[model samples]
Target: MNASPSHQPHPAEWTETQSLLPCVERDLPAGRHQFHKEQLMARIHEDLRTTTRPEPPKRRPNPFLRRTVLLPAAALALAGAVAGGFALSSGDPHGGRTALATGPALTTTVGAADAEGAPRLLDRISLAAADTSTPTPRKGQYIYIESKVASTYTSSVGDKTSVVSEELHPRQVWNSLDGKDGWLIEPGQTGDEGITLASEVVMSGAYDVLATLPTDPDALLRRIYRESDATRDHEVPRDQAAFTAIGDLLTESYPPADVSAALYKAAAKIPGVVAVDDAVDATGRHGVAIAREDGTGERTEWIFDKKTLRFLGERVVVVKAVAGSPFKVGTVVFTSAITQRAVVDANKQVPGGAS
Candidate 1:
């Protein structure tokens, strides 16, 4: 239930300062710093563009740096996939289904697995989760995560109409084990510099917070219910809030075996969770899913390996029609495949990549 920091506008003159300043100001050795402010700013701009903009305006390339300068550390945490669709399209009233290139959204007409489906599948998943071992990251280590992510937003080009755009890319994050620091490392680029994990970082992505979560199903569920209530202010349905909380936890955090098992079991207690026997991730891996439909005309599905019971990824599909949304029933608005995760020694280090 951690809230991301809201976006705040920065000084308009920051862009002018950036464009006017030299990458290397003083007489400095070439490799002493091994990083440039402009490069880091550019990388931050790109990240902001993908996460926050549908189609960023073309005024200045560095304008996004200003917007992103405002996103908090937990803002790097991916949005909860369970609340609604991934929003592959901007708010384009006339936009077509081009964003559905990965696949069309699955219509709600497709029946979810029966009421008994969740308990049975959850029992198996919980068992597997309990049996599996995920190392508890130590301080000074990095929790490295690699995933294929896609996001969408809408932009109004004029007073008359708007255009929707979607961006899909591979993202990697190296979070400090202590929840004190982190880095967002785009491929082939030095990790963006100076990321500080906020004290209120989301439970799912914060190692220290994950260690503190309750491992008992009933207790865990109650805790999530209460916390989500406080954060969402009862505006979101209890079940939806709980489900979204679980979704964020499942996708981003690797809790201890008992806590992980408890999360799945707790999800089963939520009223609307249903089973989907057939689901596919962005990586084209097929698996089963436990899903819930929100009032917002979308179904969030957490896919898991059918045989091993390992979580594969999550996806969002449109189930109802909405005005000003370029999505239709059965259109897969967003999909992400978690390709890998590991603990590393430094923020700049990834498995089999440069240190």
Candidate 2:
């Protein structure tokens, strides 16, 4: 069993946020910009984006990396933060790394979600995934995934707190199948030249790691629960963790076809999983969403094309607002669209052999 991550601050993160405790009146992990910006754009940020979901109902926010629905997902996303260049300061006296580009807080029509619609939608999605072909990376090949990502978080400066969003930006990552080697490039987060991914294996989101998981939905689901145990926030339900871990795999990972199918099937088994009739990605592509509401007032949605059942992107929305929350209902806290995923012959090589 993967035990839940202890609610202790990671040394580096503590160094990053410890001082802000006296100043930040809002709750969040991974320091966000303290800007006067009037709006927000939510992004999954994955291991690439450093945003996080809100904390559970009444608990004091844990600034620890465990702020997101899945700790592993944050860990996977941290791969980018670890292999980095400096963050662009958004006029922070606190030295928080945030982009200067800010946008209006993203909003959406609150799509109706059928409480029981998950299983059926997932089944269709599973069939679609199983029918698709996934390429296996060669020894020197890299898995390139390019996405448009944006994020939202509360920024408190001087007594005024407002929601801020990073402008939608491209995030590109090239990972070796084994997870050992990779590259990351995001303008504000990693800089223009990008950085080498020389960090530890992104255990849950790695293609090689996912390739080894069981394909049987039942078995796969059980494994998911076990692996997700580590990131469990006791205030939050364990099923949310499982759902989130699966969400990480489904979004950031390029799993094998069989594993992909099994993941959708496994997601169907998680309680509270629902199907949203309408949702949009960071790029404005509309799709159906398979979502799980973490009691923490946010619904993490995985959007897929309605016709092809192909995944388009992920969005986290504010469904039920909490007291003192800067977000309103229908507020989209995060969104990411995977524009491309392909097997590249070499590191940092994009599709069509473009570098």
Candidate 3:
């Protein structure tokens, strides 16, 4: 298990937010910016194709390389901090309920039934997004998101026995549209800090970058695939990596209505995409989903409101059972629901209420 991250004071006060919120900072793991940049550049170069000279590659520094080794560890920590509900061999065969050491725990509800296959659904979602009027904020504004997440893991007591554990938590994040400032708030921890915008990773949580993305579905899809390849760890499968890249963009950033619709259309073009109706988010809101199963027994779904066609959340489920795995077939390994999102003028200003 990874140790919890600690909160550190800002080296210097932020003049922009000193009046509204205190500048408490978090220690970002090194190389995070580099990793994001690599992903971004992949997409841009794929489109431009202007460079003929094979420039020397930029290698990660030794200190940052060591930090890169901790990426998986940090993932585990984030998983425990945000995810919840594990599966057991003894639980319901459908895996909606989990069997705890003490008793059976009623957990996630079963996913919704399949809808009009992937193609039709994606088309409708794209049309809806294009028709809707979600606001596009200015560069200095902030986007606030309130959400809940759950993660599942397995722990072995001995070679023969193990237990699956899951934890769920709520989170609030304020992102600067220009990508110069941000803040994260969760149970018992908060961070106020500075961050750089990666021009390459257009889908990353940077509104400025997202604004610059191509509006055409084909062009956008190509960019996403290229970027996914550029920053991928190589351990993940290609299709899965591409799908995850899209998911990250949808979940973490607020894109313009046109761009969002273009992305939906682009996603529909991806092979192996599927649709599910009646999926439930962590908040218990029922919606539809577009999903893809990674070759590794895990399936990721992006859930959306049925009527409004608005994004609701995302979930990860187990499609196959593996020995000693924390997740069983049909088990919901992770879920996150976006409760609220709005554009505000100040870092401390929330959309519907006080920060």
Candidate 4:
């Protein structure tokens, strides 16, 4: 792992007098320069809030439940469906059966087909539709959700064996676009309890909220791109200096190779996954490549379970920079492991009006 940069004191560091005083007052051109610098800093700070991504709502783990175990029958059914060409759900927890049905009509401009010959386009459409139909449990709504998570991490510097179990609670709801009518609820709590050699620790923290798209793969990609852009534009700048500092630190710590390897390892485990591809976006930024991993490894493609129209859980990777390093060190193998609770209202209007 890459270490943080040393905090060596520089002999030429600016003193308070030199940095704070107006240079023009002393009959020098530096005073005018100082004024301009101040103005620039002020503008940056002012624009930061508007430009930053919206902070995801607060989610707390549910405390009432301890461990949520998937019934053997359900597990086997899900595994079989994923291995085959279809997708499956455990259905509603309230004893109601909501079968996995065909997703809404949508189209995609990107992605390739997977190994089993399932059209990635259809998968995206399915996801978009599910996203639209799924309702997140809100403050007053009756929603049902079930999750299973497995997480492993090294202990903080002084501690040995890190483990925890937590129950997540729902906090807020956001509407999904892509033509499916439903809302996405950001769960506040984590469901998995961390286990270590000595003791089990309940890990409780906010998880990232993602917009589910209807089954159309292209539609799903569009929503993902849009949400990511919104996050970068609105949420990142709220704490501009802090985010910038973290970016700088990451650049100085790890090598590019290490970061790439970590990402590949995480991507390999997603179900129905075939390969990982890479590309440059329209703006020339380096973009991610997630393709179907065929036997030859030459064919580029995207992974999706055609039956349920849901992206395989393993394919969704969360990349976070390792603190003080230029490398990405940590990896979480599962995506659906994060708690997702949905509320179905036969009477309420769609959560948010379509854009």
lDDT of model 2 at residue 313? 67
Model 3 TM-score (2 dp)? 0.65
Per-residue lDDT tens digits for candidate 4, residues 63-162, read 1111111011111110121111111111222212111111111111333334333334333332343233322234333222222222111222254333
Estimate, for each residue in 248-327, the C-alpha lDDT of model 2 and write its tens digit: 56655567888888888998999999999998777777889888787767887888878878877667778887897778
| TM-score, per-candidate, Cα-based | 0.67, 0.74, 0.65, 0.25
Q: Is candidate 1 or candidate 2 better by TM-score?
A: 2
Candidate 2 ranges with C-alpha deviation above 4 Å = 1-98
How far in Å is the alpha carbon of 181 misplaced in model 1?
Answer: 1.0
Tens digits of lDDT, candidate 1, 1-355: 1211000001111111111110100111111111112343335435544553343332122111121132222122232212211111112233221222212222223335556789999888888878876666777887666555443222345653322323344545556655445555332111233232332333233566667778888988988787555443244577876776666655544566777788889999999888987876655667888888776666777778788777766666666777855556665545556666677788758676677
lDDT against true structure, model 2: 0.57
Off by over 4 Å in 3: 1-116, 156-167, 188-203, 352-355
Q: Between the candidate structures 1 and 2, which one is better when assessed by lDDT?
A: 2
The global Cα lDDT (0 to 1) of model 4 is 0.21
Error of 2 at 89 (Å): 18
Q: How do all the candidates rank in terms of lDDT, highest first?
A: 2, 1, 3, 4
Between 1 and 4, whose lDDT is larger? 1
Winner by lDDT between candidate 3 and candidate 1? 1
